[model samples]
Target: MPLGADHLIHANVVCSDFERSLDFYTRLLGARVIGEVFEFDAGEDFMTILGVTGGARCRAALLTWSDDDTATYLDLLAFADGGGHAARTAKDTGLARLGLRVRDLAAALAWIEEHGVPVVGGPVTLTPMPGRQRHVVTIRDPDGTLLTLMEFPERR
Candidate 1:
């Protein structure tokens, strides 16, 4: 069945700490919370929706970028029990990465460095079109989730 969808409404990033995740996305990447943080015992429906059989407690916050052209929603979730496990980069399969775009790639990478976040790799030029060149970088978030950041180069 082809599910007709408008666009990606939100993506979930399970974290170990709500504050840390919030700071990482909001403080670091400039995403603003769209709604209040929700806290409750992870009911059967929640666990089911998350594709899990257990884990009863969860706290989640909806996030969106202020500078983003699209809504670009992200849900920063903190789950209890094994749900709070740090991200794994091993070959074990799952949602391995999340991509993001920023206005100033260099400054964003610098922010990651200044804040002591692990950089997966240095920035590389993407589309080297004159007057519209682009760059990309890979880095690890607070929970080790890999994120790719892209931006247009500054004209000098």
Candidate 2:
């Protein structure tokens, strides 16, 4: 039996510049900035659970889409002092990515370009693994995290 997971809670991404990341996700992806938190003191304990002996002293923003009621989120984190690095290509190992579904590929791409956000690649159509044809555009967030906007052919 499959695990009865309902929806995603959140994905944490470390950013080199969180403010920039926050602006980008809101302006470009239309995510609602829900809240922000700064880690300190025993706050480092959480990191220890992840095996990072030193607790992180970072500021993070919780973002979600406007239509989302479940409150699923993407947490953008900027670790203390040692800012995070830019995201590598999607094909690169150990990299995490989020693909968002859009209603209109062309319009979405146009809106994204108008925002002056960097397009990492695509807006190209492909019959990739899911076996369904999809129109896709890959973009790099201000902190270089890879996000793909996807438009799928409506089912018959």
Candidate 3:
């Protein structure tokens, strides 16, 4: 068999408040709630995998939406105990920010600004890989995680 599959299934990020994160994902990112799981009576190792304790209250919601027939999902998790975590900033950490290719950079930046989020970078032009022109803008989420919105027009 090959080392791995050709496509990614999903990505998960920890949140201090699952409900609030769920609301952000649904309202801000336009994702739909798919499912949720609570691990209560599971074994110690299983609980650890779920980031919970034996008698802890853990909530996980799967939110998803489709873009061009591709399913984009977000896993919102919260633990009643001190097991929950927060998103980290891309500049301070080694993680690369999430990049979203959008249809309009200006409109996206306006929407982000309307939501009270500040733009970290510009809606300037750039030469993408190879020989294409692209416009990009960066914005920070409520938790300071960076997200880049890229726009590639039909002709520039």
In candidate 2, stretches whose alpha carbon ends up further than 4 angstroms from where it belongs are 1-7, 35-42, 69-71, 83-87, 129-131
Q: Rank the candidates by TM-score, best first.
A: 1, 2, 3
- Residue pairs of candidate 1 with colliding backbone atoms: 42-56
Q: Deviation in angstroms for 60 in model 1?
A: 1.1
Clashes of each: 1, 1, 0
Question: Global CA lDDT of candidate 3, please?
Answer: 0.68
Deviation from native of the Cα of residue 115 in model 1, angstroms: 1.4
**RMSD after CA superposition, every candidate:** 3.4, 3.1, 3.7
Looking at candidate 3, the ten consecutive residues that score lowest on lDDT are 34-43
Query: Between candidates 1 and 2, which one is better according to TM-score?
Result: 1
Clashing pairs in 2: 44-55
- The stretch of ten residues in a row with the least summed lDDT in candidate 1 is 82-91
Candidate 2 local lDDT, residue 58: 71
Best by lDDT: 1
Given candidate 2, what's the lDDT at residue 131?
78
Q: Residues 6-102, candidate 3: write the lDDT tens digits.
A: 7765676656766676676677766776745454433588668867557556677766666433576655666666453455665565665777677
- The lDDT per prediction is 0.79, 0.76, 0.68
lDDT of 1 by residue, 1-156 (tens): 888897877788888878888888888888887867788898888779978886577788888875463576898888666343654773559777888878888888888899888888768886656567678888888778888898855643
